[model samples]
Target: MTQYTQKVNETTLKMPVALLQVGMFVCRLDRPWLGTPFLMQGFLIDNRETLQSVRALCSHVFVDPNKSLIQLRSPRERRRSRRETPEPPTLSPTVDRDMARLGLREVLPTYTRTLKGVKQALREVGRGHPLNPERLAGQVDECINALIDNIPAMTWLSRVKSHDDYTYEHAMHVSLLCMVFGIHCGWPRHEVRQAGLAGLLFDLGKLRIPKALLGKPTPLAETEWQLFREHPKWTRYLLEKSGFEQDVVMACYYHHERPDGRGYPVRKLGTQVPLAARLIHILDAFDAMISYRPYAQQRTVYEAIRVLYHGRNSQFDAALVDQFIELMGVYPMGTLVELSSGEVAVVIGQNHDARLLPKVAIIRDRNKNPVAEHVVNLKQLRDAEGKARFRVKSMLLDGSYGVYMQEYTRHLVLDASPA
Candidate 1:
């Protein structure tokens, strides 16, 4: 409504953050796009929160006058000139209920296809075939779509399944987490696709490294370590040659670099590392910690979460780490947990508001015997006193009390009905 005039000769105009309005289009910021929470290359200022977010991160931004809904005019004249834009429709309760009832089997096909595509691409890279950018992009897009359809189902499957080969499994895991993180942060679709691609390609260079060195049980000597560190550089070269975009290349190349500048390769400090790279770094580390690598012992979900929480700001971006923890919940999916009632359960979904309370599938009864699987929404259940009916007494290891995720994952596949 504030009347302001600026030269319209240029396509982009740099204006102070104070002049930014809700309807403006922010084409570029004063700082790098990846350094801030705004992951999209460009975005429309849709609401007051978005406007404030931009203002908080930047002093000035490059705006495109053509993209904005309003032009220079007095408040009264502007109100009369422009038609009010309708707000986007919110999901109706019926739609929400349907999505809630959507079976995990409904999403598994897409998830499997995406994972298979990732494995095939990584295998091609291992065999010295030239990377296909178009194919990789398509794979990433499918992955993004699957996550959009049902994030909890995809996430649960990703955590439950593991490949015989670590390289292939790790690539898919990191890529899935990257896509999930992007969506959780409310990034635009383009940025989410880019993040997914970066995750898939981030560790392709490891294929070029010798298997002996990678699978070595003991600590690597300095020479081996130095050679191991060249994976990022190799990734950059491979992507550059494959004609991938510079942003994706940079993300894969610098994922090992850390916020505190203590990370490997170039040792980029703080925002010097791109947001996608910083995001991939967290996922890569978390996956690695919980995974069964030859050199390291597999850690429980709670242990991995602790490592990420403690390393915040020093080894990783503090805010991103917090968000990652929040996304995964205190008891992440696929985790084996013992409830207060002496039953064992596997975490299936997160309750965002209640970090400790999560939706789970009870697999074992109080006597540690196998039982019929039933989902318990911990957030919904309450005792007469209104306290949580069944609290997670303790986190269990992968194969606790004769119950294993691998077995229940099979059960889930066969009985694919909605819980």
Candidate 2:
């Protein structure tokens, strides 16, 4: 039997290969199979024999306590390997510039087009086409990249508008929201992308359901609700049939499953549900809350956030929920607010200095006239002795002002004067 030293929770354990079980914790081997080495978390350690079995499965294993260091037995071989394979260049500056450019490139047009594509894809699926996973994946990536690069400037709350195509628009919105939530949960870029894809396709199974039922403005009947609950299973089936990977399929199927076992099709609780699924669930609900459905009135972002916070532990992960609140701030981009100064403005950007005092563009005053616009960096400006003079009193929705968010956002970003 080959002896190996494994690190678990910062403590090193010396054991033979045969003693490992499903739940037995193990740090990454000195050499990983692929990509970044990951520490195993919460796996099932069924029996000692299982541990030995895993050892048999691998030909060679090396132990390393440090996650970043690779231990090569032969210094000569290591030197040769390093000479042949140089490390990839660092990407911080490049990534930052790329992200900024992506944000500024007029993505709304592309977003509108992608929305149409999603609707079209759904229609094709409804008509029994093979549920084109490749096409759907491409669309998912596009939507995610767009949203991540542009999370609405801190000031433009009312301007964050939904498109006319409800189905596709809803998909894009959910994808964006899920991306934000995933970032809050400290998910890596790949996981965040997966979460976005999952959110975009979370309701893909709805294509299999009857259009009449899906479009019903009335409350679902008991039987209809049962059918609705089975959508996740249908989603899993579709994903499997389309050859989607397991992680992607699980995320798509389990986004509706609550953490407390009250969710449908699986009733999985706590860690039973994948992290990707849980992240998507929180974001999916957030998007739905801000959305105006055919039968339900839209909730303001603040109100929607409150609902999410209230559902912590029961419906969502509490830490993730808190992080999400911090990520979006109390007043997110595109939110309209009434300031204490008797002025109405749209939140445009977050002030790096004081999160509470975001930059705003005044759109109306006490008399409610369309006036000359100027950017107000709330962090820099203050009252008499340098105290905050303005405070947000209320958040308003686009419908309340008889404006569409998409149009309003364009005007705000393009026409508003810089402060």
Highest-scoring model, lDDT: 1
Screening candidate 1 with a backbone cut-off below 3 angstroms (N, C-alpha, C), the clashing residue pairs are: none
In model 2, the runs with Cα more than 4 Å from the true position are: 1-105, 143-159, 183-186, 412-419
lDDT for model 1, on a 0 to 1 scale? 0.79
Report the C-alpha lDDT of model 1 over 15-127, residue by residue, as the tens digit.
Answer: 66756888988888888877788888999999988988886787678788789876734434445655575433321333432443354667767767777887787777777
**lDDT tens digits by residue: candidate 2, 1-419:** 23333333343443333333345444434345454223352123355454454555543333332331323123345457769997444223334333323343446655666667777877777777766667767766775565565555311221355545566666767776776666656678778777767777778888778878887889999999999888888888877887877898998787888878998777889778888788778877887778777767788888889999999999998877888788788777667777778787776667543567876767677666666655576665654444567777788876654545566655534533344
For residue 380, what is the lDDT in candidate 2?
54
- State residue 292's C-alpha deviation in candidate 1, in Å: 1.8
lDDT of 2 at 368: 63
